[model samples]
Target: MKTNLVANCHKAITNYIHHTPVLSSSLINDIVGAELFFKCENFQRAGSYKIRGATNAILNLSEEQKSKGVVTHSSGNFAQALSLAAKSIGIRAYIVMPTSAPQVKMEAVKQYEGDIILCEPTLEAREKTAQDIVDKTGATFIHPSNNTNVIIGQGTAAFELLNKHANLDAIFCPVGGGGLIAGTCLAVNSHQNGCLVYGAEPFEADDAYRSLISGKIETNDTTNTIADGLKTQLGDKNFPIIKEHVSSIIRVTEEDIIEAMQLVWERMKIIIEPSSAVTVAATIKSKLLVKGKKVGIVISGGNVDLAKLPF
Candidate 1:
């Protein structure tokens, strides 16, 4: 995976990905008790780091394949990403989203002029609908998390992080479908073996944590997390890489997420959704106890609906 990923798609995903800066913050660093280097991927185009994977997946396709168009199932961000990329390339895109996905995200897909299909919130239903669309249209399916190309493209985030700060002691990212963390672990393990990789999840959606501990895939019963973007089961492609390189999993509460969101908005002046805030939440509440570590955290996305906030 490393050889195939690093050697091949890294260059392909460059300019399209923001390479969002890693800034040192006294507020975050002081509160967390570490030199907190925040990789502000919240600044990524398409409101997330997903643009890299979407671009990579599209570019890897043959002209005939692209001519046939692309389709995928996503909770939201990937849908918006692929929609934007597909529009840019003059290719058709179909995005199947769960009915429960954030309305704002669905609107973004529509704004990109994507054909949106709503499915029941279950993974099986979403995938089935996506496959049906693919079969009906001859469009290639781009798995949101499981594909080698997508994972490698995601790895570029951690790759950019390390390129900026080589001597970091650890990297933290919120986990969901595991594309971001799995790719991040691969990049960090190959480039910074000394740095620990941590996956942060809301307690309500802590499937990755349980899955890692039990040495098998696990699902959470309480899928009622506000972190809507971190709401998918782990995929086969992401599982082995996680089991291999992930240092540990940390769980944060809903309160922690809210506080973290407030922290970014008040101190960092950044608007992050609940899912992206999980990295900040776990960093401050769960893993901040790791004193003296130089920790780098990827703020995955910043596409929050601020008008809904009571603030």
Candidate 2:
């Protein structure tokens, strides 16, 4: 909520998470007619920026709460993040994953020593399963993006980005449940001079885009986008922050998402998940707005199932 809270979170999780690299591609810059700095969170511990928030959330728990352990429902990166973060702090993690979630993500959660609870692929099922765990085990349920500590923790990525380059004209992030972009808005506004925050969302699942215009949270009837990580709707906690801080939300098509993913893999030689690629696709789609400016792109994660490449 406050800049100092984010700074304190950074201090708490400094040794726990990676200060991921900021990379730039000349070819990419030329293509967009802007100097782009890509914060490569794909190299982060647990292979995503979720670790920042997950670690912070775990570390902030009291001794009593820590004894009860932690639990969350995530089908992808956050599942892996909470597992690894809790393991690092010698706490147990309970992960409720949908049966339809990619096998690779489920396996990664196990690899990090998280206890997995498989449930039907529905929001209701996932939440119910997680709540059952909390009731039975007394574990605290951590909402992936809605928790205040998680939001502050996620802000660290942009904090580090602005620390390295303070003159960015804008920072772009892919919005799912909206933690990353909400946190990003706080960090950039708190630390930098006047860098604007922008959100990238898939047209197929543009709840955040619509929510901003409607002045309330929105949901999608069907999530038919390849950017699986951005399929979730914005939470109440993060929606207000995003509405106040984010400059705009750019909705990109499925084709543009694939093209952007391929471009990063081919040109930057980085393996970014489709969710991460949405930011690049949005940036490309709004080339004129970013032209002759310094831009920062937050590559949210690199966790992808190799067998399911959308190329």
Candidate 3:
């Protein structure tokens, strides 16, 4: 990917997306043994950083494609993002979601005027359903993590982060489909500074970690993690960038995920989902990876189900 892609994407989507604040906690800094900056995408529009990519992807669409509309399959954040993004541009968005997805997220998508198509709670079902929509409506298919435009858009979050804290030693982000982290890598790489990028993953859905080891995209044998958003596997498009730029993938346990989630809520007083907490958990679990170094952690989103609080 061109280095200028992230800069161009940031410019294109600046008005559409939030330049979310970078937060720091003395307590968290003490625990992690580093001056950590949390790029809080949890406070972003549609309640996640997914809005950045969704808005950019829609903006880059041809007028004919926009007129025909767009379609994608997402369990939560991207569904709400695409819905809101399309609505802002006065276009239709078809979101295929798993039947088992959080009700709160499903409702958020509806509130954004997205047409939700329910499918079996499986990746195959979601993809097939979304493809069916594209086939019938002649709508453009925007893969949540796998498309080039979407990846560039996702990088804008990190681009914004790096712009604020140009001297960061490293950055840790939760990896699911790898879009966010891949974009993050691009953003960090674009800088002349030698800032490293790391990915955090739940042990239950360690496909990205395993893929990095084997040098090929891998699938999860089980999707039993509390970090619902990190359950998706990396795609061919984002995986290559991740493998090339990410320093390493740290796998954290479910217990650690909850502990980190509770820590951020109790300390930072921020509402972050389990997926977002994975980055913090990984940092706490592997202090050796970034000891004494000033680092940045991307708080990916804040769309947790209130009724299902793990704490």
Best by TM-score: 2
After superposition, the stretches of candidate 1 with alpha carbons farther than 4 Å from their true spots are 1-4, 99-102, 286-289
Number of colliding residue pairs in model 1? 0
Evaluate all candidate structures by whole-model CA lDDT and list the values in order: 0.85, 0.93, 0.91
- Candidate 2 versus the native: TM-score? 0.98
Q: What TM-score does structure 3 among the candidates reach?
A: 0.98
Task: Name the 10 consecutive residues with the lowest summed lDDT in model 2.
Answer: 1-10
Better of 1 and 2 by lDDT: 2
Off by over 4 Å in 3: none
- Candidate 2 deviant stretches above 4 angstroms: none
Backbone clashes (count) for model 2: 0
For residues 150-183, could you state the per-residue lDDT of candidate 1 as single tens digits?
Answer: 8888888888888789988898988998889988
Residues 195-249, model 2: lDDT tens digits: 9999999999999999999999999998999998998888888998999999999
